[model samples]
Target: MARKPAAAYPFSSSPGSSSARPPQPNTNLNALRIPVTPERRPGAPSPSSATTTSAASSASRNPFLTPSPGTASASPSPAQAGRSTATNRPYGTASAANSSTHLMPPSAASSTASLVSSSGSSLRPQPTSGNTPRAALSAPPLNTSSKSATTAPPSISDKFSLSPDPSLWGGNLSLSDREADDYLHNPDPKRDRKNDRGGTMFTARGIVNLGCLFIMAAGLIALFAGYPIISFFTTTHQSTQGGYNLGGINQTGQVPEITGALGLIDVQTPAASKSHTGWMDQSTYDLVFSDEFNVEGRSFYPGDDPYWEAVNLHYWETNNLEWYDPSAITTTGGNLKIWLNKTENHDLNYMGGMMSTWNKFCFTGGYIEVSVSLPGDPTVWGLWPAIWTMGNLGRAGYGASLDGMWPYTYESCDVGTLANQTQNGGPPDALTTGDPDWNGALSFLPGQRLSACTCAGEDHPGPQDSSGNFVGRAAPEIDILEAQVYQSTRTGAVSQSVQMAPFNAYWQYTNTSNADFQIYNAEITEANGYLGGVYQQAASSVSITNQNCYSGHQSGETGCFAVYGFEYEPGDSGYITWINNGQPAWTVYAPALGPDANTGIAQRPIPTEPMYILANLGISENFGAIDYAELVFPVYLLIDYVRVYQKQGSTNIGCDPADHPTAQYIQNHIDAYSNWNLTTFDDFAAVSGSTWPKNKLIDTC
Candidate 1:
């Protein structure tokens, strides 16, 4: 913006220029420099004196030399008629200031480098009291461009008027970024100039502009105030395009701004075969899950929820995976046995585990993979410990199969009977229509399931062999069958992996993954085709969708589903996952299977479909311990290393069939909370049963 036919304001010499002639080029840089720091000694060659020599050398060296004797005559150097001007310059060294050495003003730089008019005319010298003007001009132009061209050191005291070079302060005083922004991006500078002042210091016009800005700001603010849904997209676009680092979780919700829409969920795993300990809940983690499971009799002891458990646990797991750990169960370094006394242990070993709101925790839809590392042990045998999710669902006989719909009933369902339905081929094909234990005898055999726990009359749900009678609290098996999310680890839920086994054991090696360590992952159903932008999806959208009518493209269909599928990346995201031998992980989708759920162009499910998540960890025999568990859907605990990413511009579009799309999950519920176990990043620490201690859910700030 330095407008100039004036050759870009080539050089503006002040009235105090000392050189009578212009210097030629070819001068060494060292010739022109002043002492750089405080160490420069006094009586050193003065920059003014050096300038005199360099100018002579400059004039003698180059053919392009030009001089302005006339201009130099009009303006003598300030030192010639010493005048003090600076108001706040700091004091300088006494010797440097008072010695025979001609001193450069502490405030102003040496005035010897002033450029001559370039006309090559000799300047009319000022009438010196003793010396003749001709005598001053006689020294062969003083080699105008001398080899030692010098400029005086800047004044460090409050003596001389100040003048600084452009380089001294390049980026310090910016035209207020906002004002500059208005000037740059906005074409109208009048209102902007007015508002610019208003933003800093108010004026009449600034106030008016301020009022207008407030109105506009209010309108912009109203655009997505409570409407987390639309706010996610717009704000995300703004943050990314404007250059901001966004959080993976915060992108879905607001950070530093607490909203029911952004909270964690509480999930409890079934007790280990030998020890009964449930999954971690969200309340402890200072977060809330969307969908929650109802427990008959469970105890909550203060902060024993999600928050405290979120502490980095490298030491806990490092010392816990015992040398002879049974394949079934996971052991940790932070031994729970010593930390929690008898009273605490009693509280830790609960009868039933509770679930949080599913809608609140996980993404409504997309592939969420949980990375897990299974202990290579054959002795673990017969352990089925699963990491699955559950939600409320109802089926209406054959009506749900072809018509692509299921009715929501307010009635509680039979846990076993509910399990019988909600499977491929509607019972007869993949599941049993009646009691396979009574009717088919061995027909109910667990296929490759080491932890089936079938002991003749044991197939029935109600009575325990030791307890006798068939009567027991009947809860619908709705979870097992209706559960659409799952993936298995390399081991089983047989009594061996998750519980203690009483016998000499050997760690078995198996590249083969069993059904016991399975997990179920499913995403949420939203109002339209899907939630989230093509590249950067937002959780806020789903949260504010119904409440604020803020949704993405193609709104209007109503099944609210979220993403809870299993992670299947290799090496980096993890070597092993919930299912497969860390390969080909199985993800269950109702009405969508095989090619349909495969994530190809043809497999995308449309419309809003209500969905939930579930996993099954079955233990047939007692396990010595569970090495570790995987959570398909993400939670703060299940991550190897979480990275918050924000993209600029509008690269985000819609769902991608090539890869599973992460849809926004309503963060308002508890059951939707999935685990993002950070243990995934932990350097596998070798531990023994003696050092391994389980974590007792401790809820604390």
Candidate 2:
């Protein structure tokens, strides 16, 4: 049901026209132009006032368009049925109805006043508001429908008075800007509360802050122009053992800190023992064991937090632990800082920053046993995880204890020799000075060695001159453990020592003396004296000292620094001040000492044929850390410098430092003995060639 528009609002003349009557355009501007209207002439654009034809069609159903009930004037007596007055009107507005009689019959005013619209002719004007009558008349055939004077009412006194919408002409009655604004912004009264919209502001601030941060960072870079940038990798170069080598197992970027996390070459750490991600880069991983110390010396690993996964080597990535700046160990200037953390991330095999050199780098021939500190708490396992190496490592086939003994036992150590000794050898008291073993033991000459500065009872064997002055010096039975190969010292030298006695012990107990040993992929041998695992069986020197060379009941005594480093000045050896965390205790030693072949100590004692570097942590089952390992390739060992120098030569064929095939290959032949994966005789035998049972001693079989 459509309603006809109200009586056509006579297009009120413009307000400005009040005083200055202007010419009118032929058509009406009653409504916006409907260009789509059919009446639009062919090719001629329609007027802006064009209206819809449907408006006329809808006039029939709507009473309002029916001329308002009885609005017909001068009833045509039913004669003017087909004759009608019609015109377009804007939607919803009334059409201006007036007496056509006035236009044509000026004198018929009275009759027209009382007369209604000609029955079906057109709308009639009455005294709806004003008290005046309009003359009756018929509209001229100018197509009143089309525009003419075009169709504004004969006269409209006031434009605003003609319609309610003054805004249609840009007047105050229209929706003023302020009114529109108020309507849109009125907002709910309830909305009057504290509004903290940190939306766009936050985003903009974030962008600004981000910009500031970048600027600050750039400034910092400029501040430290010469310093290396802390970037991950541009992948600009390849990973070599040198020149950005990244050391295979180490992080490729700046390491802001390292604390609870393992070092680059993480040794037998809880991390390595569990997860198996970096099993391919074991050697470099072992270095991380450098921080295996736990709670004042107890070992810490996944055992403490079974949920520890690979520790992100990047300091910034350390979300678990706190970052600390200590007085030591920094890649930058000033104080060294160590950022450490412990978190839970899937905790898969539970590994990281831990590794080994089962058959990597270069280490073969005579056994090596590492002795490091053990945790004070046995219940807390992983206290003495070791980081010993070996190469060439081929032992007596299966029964030989070490299948890769020759190359396998190259760098080996008894697991926790101090407490786990019976399995590796007899006790310290039962330790036979010299013995040949295949699995992994070292043989040292009888008696210890002491310097001229100390007494005879210190590892010294015979008298000096004729003064009965001194016999031999004291012998270092075994103390703390060894470190993971050589570390990067301050000065970057590579000189270190391994106690040959324990390796001898390892070999003796295993009963396979002929196993080969290698170092840095070269046959294990002295620079000139001992050639490739061969030492003169002939007797050597015997020196002992009261310090670091005592024996028997006194040997298992309080504390001592068994191994001291010296300058690589061809012949000058030095010692470290003995101090237990800071306790005063003179090192125990014997009178004099002797060497089978190896010699460099002040006493020129016997050369340790096949030395073993025991994991210091494993040695005590308590100290739980590598006893002070001093690798003083230090041209001046006295300065505590010197790093293990890797020549970075071209290898014809072997482990690829780039892809790290060595560690992978070793993992294929090795397995850590743990609860989840206990080492079996078969597993150990697979690699224990000739002397299988002898070398692989964790025999649950």
The lDDT of each candidate is 0.22, 0.24
Among all windows of 10 consecutive residues in model 2, the one with the lowest summed lDDT is 633-642
- Model 1: lowest-lDDT 10 consecutive positions: 496-505
The TM-score of candidate 2 is: 0.27
TM-score between model 1 and native: 0.22
Q: lDDT value for candidate 2? A: 0.24
> Model 1 misses residue 177 by how many Å?
71
Tens digits of per-residue lDDT for model 1, 85-179: 11112222122222212223221122222222243233222222221111121111212342442333344332332223221211223354355
* Best-performing candidate as measured by lDDT: 2
Quantify how close model 1 is to the true structure by its C-alpha RMSD in Å.
Answer: 29.7
Residue 151 Cα positional deviation in candidate 2, in Å, after optimal superposition: 18
